[model samples]
Target: MSNPDTSSGTLPSHEIIVIPPSGHQDRLLLLDQCIHVRIDVFVHEQQFSLDVEVDEHDPIATHFLLRLVPSLTPIGTIRAYRAEGEKYYKLSRLAVLKPYRKYHFGRDLVLALHRWVNEDAIRSGLQVARVVCHSQLPVKGFYAKYGYQPEGDEFDEDGAPHQKMVAYPS
Candidate 1:
């Protein structure tokens, strides 16, 4: 179902803001909101351990925060990082607030993150071949809608079925 305006019959405007990489002075601006989204979705709702939900990668991964316009409250987040010795990025910790899921925030976050990564790679003269994610099994089709393909056999991750999916930047 689509997210509909409650009173005026219009949805609220929103935007995605990319968090600077670790060590940047502005990096902490959205880090709390990003962690809030992850805790809500992955830890509390999805039964993932707090330690697992907030892991080592969080400090280094590039994050994107979705903010509702006007109020500017963050409601969704996604992150990505390049693997050592690899020519692609690993996308992870995508989470949308429960109340904002109907607005396609998750999809928007993914697309924006992909674009940001591609642009950065180009600027740095890095040849990034693809964006990869370990997608929860039930949502594999969601990633497929964005041109991601399953790369290998499905496996269990944090008690949920997961599949390695890959998508090339256009």
Candidate 2:
């Protein structure tokens, strides 16, 4: 069952739930909300190119959202896509509203995604869950705290520094 707080309606102040993509309508809604919040933070606010942020893979990927109570406003989102020719999932596009940053919503979003991916993998008989975040120098440690390891030297994405990282279930 989907969390009532995050279902298709208004919620109260103390609750928020993550929803899974099940059908076309649900998937489209999740994509729009996720893209909106991510672009607002990564593109418009941070000056990252919009082209780099919105990608063709979004339409088919699994998406999730966190919403505010009473207002049903979207507060955060995360997504994962299957890497071609591989048995792993690539988690990406994690974002949360600026006002909610200090409350660990970002980490919560990640943990939620981790749960979703792990369950899906076990159900499908898959072996690993992998994620790559733009190695923002400061946040590399953050990802490390969650078990992601840097795979290579830093690279640039829309003029911002980044590095590839991966996570595996223990």
Candidate 3:
């Protein structure tokens, strides 16, 4: 589905602003907005514990945030990072506000991460590489829409069932 502004009708390019990973302190401050959305969706809405919400990977991971145009309200977030001595990035913490989910905000966030992964691959002197995520069982189809396939057995993550989904970024 095409993204539509809150008021209805097609959203213009300017209706959305995506903040990509850049500097150090600036990114950290902006990441606070992303963490807010994650807490709302993962901890509060989904009843996950706060302890599992944030982890050590956060500091080094590249983050992205999507905000409303004029209001600058953060509505979605995702992160990408390669594991220690690993080549592929692990996409994680993808979330979109409940009311904004109908606008395909999650799709936009994932695509933005993919673009970042592609760029990172080029910077590392490669064409593209594998990307993976521990996708919640319920959103398996959603991840599949972006070429991710379940590659392993289901397991528990933060008390919820999850599957290891893999994809190749391009």
Candidate 4:
């Protein structure tokens, strides 16, 4: 899918690239930005337990970063990791900077991940792709709109109520 209009209402000179986990040095820098945003938002702002925010899995997980042109500053990030013994991909730690949230960057980041997963599945000859999301209870409907279904009862994570949800793409 095409990216949403993030051009400040005027044409933008910068281009947005989605870097996979295996990308090179520059890509690793972008991934770091994504992790930083998540830590800032979920760990600091929301007071989520610090332990819930960082983990050893990060180094091996797939990450996505949204970089602006010219300055090339990363403004948003999302991550995906293998789940259920590599049978599914769990998407987590999605965050966009406060100033850039108005541009629909979060949605764009998600769509980019979805596209990447689809492409990966095709190349690997897989029939379907799976993504799991841990969503705040009230916002579960937002994910539902994207075809995610609750997997089980609500659970508490980092002191906040969340529901486990899964999406299957054929």
Best by TM-score: 1
The C-alpha stretches of model 1 lying farther than 4 A from their native spots are: 1-9
lDDT of candidate 3? 0.82
Model 1: how far is 119 from its true place, Å?
Answer: 1.0
Candidate 1 on 12-82: residue-level lDDT in tens? 58999988776778787779888987898888888898877887888778889998888778889999988
User: Please, what are the lDDT tens digits per residue for candidate 4 over residues 16-84?
Assistant: 466545657676766667777787678766778877687877877777877777767766788777753
Expressed as tens digits, the lDDT of each residue in 20-99 for candidate 3 is: 45564577667899899899889988999999889988878888888876767777789889988898789999998776
Q: Number of backbone collisions per candidate, in order?
A: 0, 2, 0, 0
State every prediction's TM-score relative to the real structure: 0.89, 0.82, 0.88, 0.80
Q: Best lDDT goes to which candidate?
A: 1
Off by over 4 Å in 3: 1-25
Backbone clashes in model 2, listed as residue pairs: 11-70, 135-163
> Looking at candidate 4, what is the lDDT of residue 102?
50
Report the Cα lDDT for residue 87, model 4. 65
What's the TM for model 3?
0.88
- Candidate 1 backbone collisions, by pair: none
lDDT of 2 by residue, 28-134 (tens): 67567778999888887788888788887676677778876666778788877776666877878888776566566777778877887888788878866655555
